[model samples]
Target: MSSATKYTRGHATFNVISKAILAGFATACLLPFILMIIGSFTDNTTVLVNGYSLFPEKWSLAAYELIFKYPKQVIDAYKVTIFVTTVGTAIALTITTISGYALSRPTFRSRNRIALYLYFPSLFGGGLIPWYIMMTQVLKLSDSIWALIIPSLVSTYNIFLVRNFIRTSVPLELFESAKIDGAGELRTFGQIILPLITPVTATVGLFIALGYWNDWFLSNLFITTSSKYSLQYYLYNMLNSSKALQELKAISGDISIEIDLPSETAKLAMAVVATGPIIMLYPFVQRYFVRGLVIGSVKG
Candidate 1:
């Protein structure tokens, strides 16, 4: 009957209720994706007949088989995507962190002006033709993997986020102390600043990785050779070709040839295949990502 016991019970009850609510919302968000995966495994005929039920009458692996039939193409695309994502993320993080740290420093005389210059492009960008000419005719990066990695190497928005995070998260006294201890700029940045802003670093890194992984437009514009296609572009071309084949069959009545086209189920399977590996990365970094966003937003 004590007041303290009642307060503990009430707080515990509220906490449980909150967790249950969040769990429900999470399930709600996840259910459609789960159903999409299950639907992909379901037979194409069953999907056509039943219209995408979670529990279908038949199961098939036709979609996955179709994808892996071109093993060399798929593997090559995977290598390209992995290389671009890894290299792009590393380069992006380095540039963003360095620029951010410099901008966060009070002693940097032109930090504000340089920040404005960086921010300007995000608000106003040159038209597509100019950029295309610049990349192709000027830089001559077409038909190469460099085209994908180079253009998106730096994000002004990410730089500002990191700058704000560093300004608000790290104490000014730490920098002064490091300077007094005879540490050079590089030494202080490497030994002191980098370690302190790990959360934000990981957060920005994840963003850059996702951007690189999901990018297909850049590939469409720059890549002419099939050998250089990224995974997203490969999948996009796969889906488009499949659709075109279906249309050809419908229009030409090509039952004589017996062509096998990818169904709706197959498209869903492609999505799962393309996205599954990248999705696995989120769980490993989810904690830091959430914490980083909270600290960055609240502190800034």
Candidate 2:
């Protein structure tokens, strides 16, 4: 055989092996989600009781029916989640971008000290009890929607992401040109810096939105009212409500309510529901993350 033929054969074998490894990694990441999604549709219950089955022996829509029975509650949860995700992401991006821009500027004498100040939050947030009391008693924010929105307004990590992107991406000459154009600091930021950082902003915005959408802990703590609960927390309580004595007794007691809730399935389905929009969003937003990082490459 010719040397070229031998080399080609070896390269083809390497590509096949590389593809196989990647497929395995992808499966590892995706299989759980697939199982969870399928389980939601399955008639199966717990791991102890019903083994993991993708398809069901007896197909049932009872889980969905029960979920829909409280349509208003579900809708309200969706509203709260949507509201929090939108508002929180917007506020966070603005704050993070502005902070990042200031930090990225070389002339800012106190930049290092400022960075240290912001970074301190990452290492030394007070205990949860103190933070909760500060929000609830002193601020009188318990059971309020502000309880959910206000605390999540900024993240130290996101600020760093924006700073990194801005430091590397935004050109100093552009800032100088804007100053020469008679643009004030706000104008320079609004017209120049923001437009250029679209990639990172979109990427970070999605991150912020997902964080708010998925969060249930804050709602559990400061929020006591059912109406004010975000979608994730609302679903959390509903998910556990399967074992609630009243729900069980009612399902059994009422002939009119012949609903057989596949509570386990509903939990899975609700998770799928809660995450569906986010999953759809990821592909589009993920495109931004790479392109943004590339656009923001640090120049020497």
Candidate 3:
């Protein structure tokens, strides 16, 4: 009968309702991935006949078997992708954070001009032909792993994200305090600024890693040797080859040659394979990612 007891009950009910809604929303988001994973295991014919389902009538490993038919190639592609993602993310985070910090500092007189130079490319590009010529003819990066790492080393958008995050989330007094302690730019950055911007750093690092991981365009353009192909590019080639085989079979109607290439299921399988590592990586940065985005986009 007490007023405080009624308020407590109301708050508890609100919490329960909120949690239930969030749980349902989370399940809705997760169902598609579950279906895709299950659908990949479903028989190709069954999928065509019944469509995707969480519980498929017939489950098969044909798609996975085909993907891993040559395990060595997949493994090599994984190695290349891992190397590129690791090295590229490190270098990218370094450059982006440094550039962002410099631009965020009010003492830097040329920051506005430098930022204009950085932002100009985001709005306009010099066309792909020139970029390709520069990469292949001038830089001589063709068929080299550096080709993959160098081109995507610094993202303008990422630099801006870091700059904004630092400008908004970090205080100018911290920089001054570090300077007062006789710390140089590098020392202040490493000792003070870096730790304070952990959320944005994780967020930017995740973005860079995902970009490097999912990149297939650079591989398709610069890489001639199959050995240097990234995982996504390798899987893309495999999927294309599967489609080609399907098309060939369709074209060669009366030949009576049996070809059992999983097309739809192969695509599902490739998605699963390519996204596995990224999915695993997401949970680690999920805590920082949302916070970083909010603070970084606060219009500081």
**Local distance difference test, per candidate?**
0.86, 0.77, 0.86
State the number of backbone clashes in model 3.
Answer: 0
Task: Please say which candidate is ahead in TM-score: 2 or 3.
Answer: 3
What stretches of model 2 exceed 4 Å from their correct place? 1-18, 43-51, 243-262, 289-300
Which candidate, 1 or 3, has the higher TM-score? Answer: 1
- Tens-digit lDDT track of model 2 for 189-258: 7888888878778877776777799999989987887878888897788666655644667767854432
lDDT of candidate 3 over 1-300, digit per residue (tens) = 455654677888997999999999999999988988998898988888988888899999998997788678778889999999999999999999999989988999999999999999889999999999999999999999999999988887888887887888788898889889999999988888899888788888887888899999999999989989999998888778767776787897733433455458877987798888778868877776787677666866
Q: What stretches of model 3 exceed 4 Å from their correct place?
A: 1-31, 44-54, 254-267
For TM-score, the strongest prediction is: 1
* Global local distance difference test of model 3: 0.86
Return the candidate ranking by lDDT, descending.
1, 3, 2
RMSD of each: 3.8, 4.9, 4.3
- Off-target runs (Cα >4 Å) in candidate 1 are 1-28, 48-50, 255-260
The total number of steric clashes, by the backbone 3 Å criterion, in model 2 comes to 1
